[model samples]
Target: MTATERPDVRPANPHFSSGPCAKRPGWTVKNLENALVGRSHRSKPGKARLVEAIEKTRSVLGVPADYRIGIVPASDTGAVEMALWSMLGARGVDMLAWESFGEGWVTDVVKQLKLKDARILKAPYGELPNLADVNFDNDVVFTWNGTTSGVRVPNGNWIADDRKGLTICDATSAAFAQDLAWPKLDVVTFSWQKVLGGEAAHGVLILSPRAVERLESYTPAWPMPKIFRMTKGGKLNEGIFKGETINTPSMICVEDYLDALNWADSIGGLKSLIGRADANTAVIAEWVGRTPWADFLAKELDTRSNTSVCLKIVDERVTALSEEDQVAFAKKIADLLDKEGVANDIAGYRDAPAGLRIWAGATVETTDMRALMPWLDWAFAEAIASLKAAA
Candidate 1:
């Protein structure tokens, strides 16, 4: 366990933050050279680029022909906020929270929106709330994947096929790497920065026919902001779904996303993307199987995420330390890896328990994940040695 004995092979690509994840293996700035930089987004060519992005997204995600998809502002957060503000007041809502982002939505429903009949369902960082307890009679809001905790719903089997209320889902981290049951989901939202590794500040909002019906038929009691408004004069605004954005957009970022979509298409579409993510997680799973000190933060294997794979240090020596000391020890491991240029931003989310969180999405290379395992071992040994010296 000598800290001095470092691994000779390093990951060729070391950019693995959960968001703004690793780009396609061969991506370059030169790829965006044809971006419509100086033109107005309202122009014919500009709108065509936006339309192409939407069309490609629909094709790759296998969204239904009857469903509507729009690119929105403020990334996934904006898309989720728009859905919550515009639709939740129409019915009693079920809000589920198992991680930071899910908890944020709960706060908005209870504190901000002040919905009287909202039911809060919660679980700790390593687990999920009871799916059986959710009342499909009420509008349901939940995350398909808990990014900060690395736990996700096993599948969409629990959702009722004949439910009366709309199901709003914030699926920013789950869209590409996992299967999203579109029939069960009424409102689905994701960002460009996640599985596809494109730039941020934009979100993709997909809506089933039922969700559109809710928007067109019922309006929230609260005043809707201009960005959140999806209807005009008691009808759904058809232009927004057709790439006519409510506000100006970054053409450069749109081109980057198009490039990412083109890459996904070239590599065999959604099936290939899911396979890549699963393979990356398998590499980490193998490492965790033999390493006594490292374990998944997820409590159940069925719910474990293939994309944002979180790990907790279970070594007796480290666990015996004070809570603050344990956090510092985890930081030390991450810092060592950072200093050695083997990994970056592998530290867990600030609100979660002290651990490592690695991005294993479609864009991350499996070879890099294999290369990362030995470095993690080296870093953990070094951190433990440092603790003994300090004591």
Candidate 2:
């Protein structure tokens, strides 16, 4: 059935999934029509559009003057792997793990790369790996925002200015919603499908001068794949940052990203984008304050993520349910919201316990989130009543 035809049980509000977030206010069929389709990506027009996107992104995001931005192979994961495989091994590596994504990167380093000297700094989900414990003498990998647990580092003040090692940051959900202190970050990776609400498949890699030096000077002992190789014979590939993708890209996705970027610009750039996210999250924060049964999953207020707000049912009654029953109950509430179309994909990550995850990304309006809060309350109440009857 069409969106307009959905039953009254569904709240009249848009969805707030973590990735593939809600499209911008004016995103429409006509916008898609303007996208480049069935066009040669290597052609002048295609290259020009690509360059425009890169420049627009830099302008909107306020990237540093010397940094290079490249459109890489896979989404954020690919860009991050490329950086890790290319620039690491010259020095001892420090892998920080606080959530699933960070843990995945650690697995890649120790298990996949088999790096023997890597240092691991870990914390339970919803908390940060010790920032002060990090050794500035080694290359460090970290996620600026923990999407699954809804925790984030408050700022970059902890990073040493004179540190010798590169700081690789996975800022997938953090890029547009939060201010990036670029001076402290060396190699940063993100996807189009995140805060911009564009299509996925390609990742954006931003490299600092130090990162470029590493790429040109030191190569990983392991064999480099063509896609991961950013330098040839000790020289950086300048064209890659100028819209020359390593492989063929979907121009449709490119144009869609451009659409999102344009929308971002129209809304007054990063400030406005962050404002929307902050406002959307505030709605949830208010709800959390009033709802005794639910509380934020993040441990501290300063660490709470504005983009992906994770919540857990705090009622002791929920803990009393069998593990399977608790999962079933949470899934029932998620399915109820999904069927109603008030929200979709609010279920927490598989590694996380039975909980709810709401995307309060910039593209999602505060009004939409406000409307969605009641629906969540209703769905939870109804699901709990059903579970009680069954019990």
Candidate 3:
């Protein structure tokens, strides 16, 4: 194939990175034209909007009725930190890390918090550690979906129904697109930048009745930062959970989130949202099945993430290169897509294996995913040709 005419069928929207992903299909600046940007977040209108975001999120995600949901300062990281700093150390901890984000949590618990009773269960990218090895009697901290590795725990069956301690989950990449087993989770956190495709800089923190109890009953020996503090007088700050955030929040982002939630509601709520992601993933999965040179990094169909779908180049021409050359080749494929205006930021994460990562959350249309496939093949060919020319 000589350098030929670009595919006429381009993705309508090619803004697919893993996070801060493509916004809702019809999103526009006008959607947020009425946001209370200059007003204080505590004002009646501002607070009402925030509360509406929380409620809409609850409705879309099907979070349990009793779970307490709140808006927090940082993205998903902030929400997880608050849960860890406010409610770890009363018991031993089991940290499961399959990729970068999960490993960060392990570092915090084992090295930063210096929890002597902590146990780390780790696996390389594209695989999950043995869920059965975890002792649910001890506090468990894990990511529901490994955004970097493209692997996720299949389900909550491994988590004991009657566990002794809390289950802290970093679900930034999973919520909304995947059904969370709320009964098995004590603390769940996600950023607005993920599946909903809202703006970044804020996180939603949901706590089960058990997680709140832990927060109220325990205090860590480490000094909790101002941002991580979730308790007042050793009791849960009920106001925060009711939409009174601990600090100022970007009203614009809140309004954007509301717009996204409304869009999600227009399409049939959670069940429909999950179906969208599944269909988008199926497009890529189908392509991978037929593409001779590429395969999903996630080997197990059950564990492959529907949102952050990672793929590896398996052609001998690409893989026979040195490690550094392999990464360069992967980058060239992604960069070729970018140069053609068919994709952007599709490169694998720095800490992840050399591959391509495409965001297939509900916000992304399956037609766009289908359109992107031919471009991916074109880019792969161009990248390999360039490498041969260079050699």
Q: Identify the leading candidate in terms of lDDT.
A: 1
Model 1 per-residue lDDT tens digits across residues 1-391:
3434788889999887898889988999999999999999989999999999999999999999999999999999999999999888888999999999999999999999999999999999989999999999999999999999999999999999999999999999999889999999999999989999999999999999999999999988888899999999999999999999989999999999999999999999999999999999999999999999999999999999999999999999999988888888888988888888889999999888989999999999999999999999889988888888988
Question: Which structure among the candidates has the greatest TM-score?
Answer: 1
The residue ranges of model 3 lying beyond 4 angstroms of the native Cα positions read: 1-5
Q: What digit string (tens of lDDT, one per residue) describes model 3 on residues 1-391?
A: 3323457789989899998999998999999999998899999998999899999988889988999999999999999998888889999999999999999998888788899999899999999999989998899999999999999999999999989989999999999899899999999999989998999999999999999898888878888888888889988888898889999999999999999999999999888889999999999999998889999999799999999999998999988989888999999989888887889999999988899999999999999999999888888878877887998
Which residue pairs clash within candidate 2?
A: none
Evaluate model 2: give its TM-score: 0.96
Write candidate 2's Cα lDDT for 32-117 as tens digits: 78667778878899899889988988999999989999898899999999998998899998999998999999999999899998
Q: What is the lDDT of residue 210 in candidate 1?
A: 97
Superior candidate under lDDT, 1 versus 2: 1
Model 2 local distance difference test score: 0.88
Cα displacement (Å) at residue 159, model 2: 0.9
CA displacement after TM-score superposition, residue 33 of candidate 3 (Å):
1.0
Q: What is the C-alpha lDDT of each candidate?
A: 0.94, 0.88, 0.92
TM agreement with the true structure for every prediction: 0.99, 0.96, 0.98
Query: Can you rank all candidates by TM-score, best first?
Result: 1, 3, 2
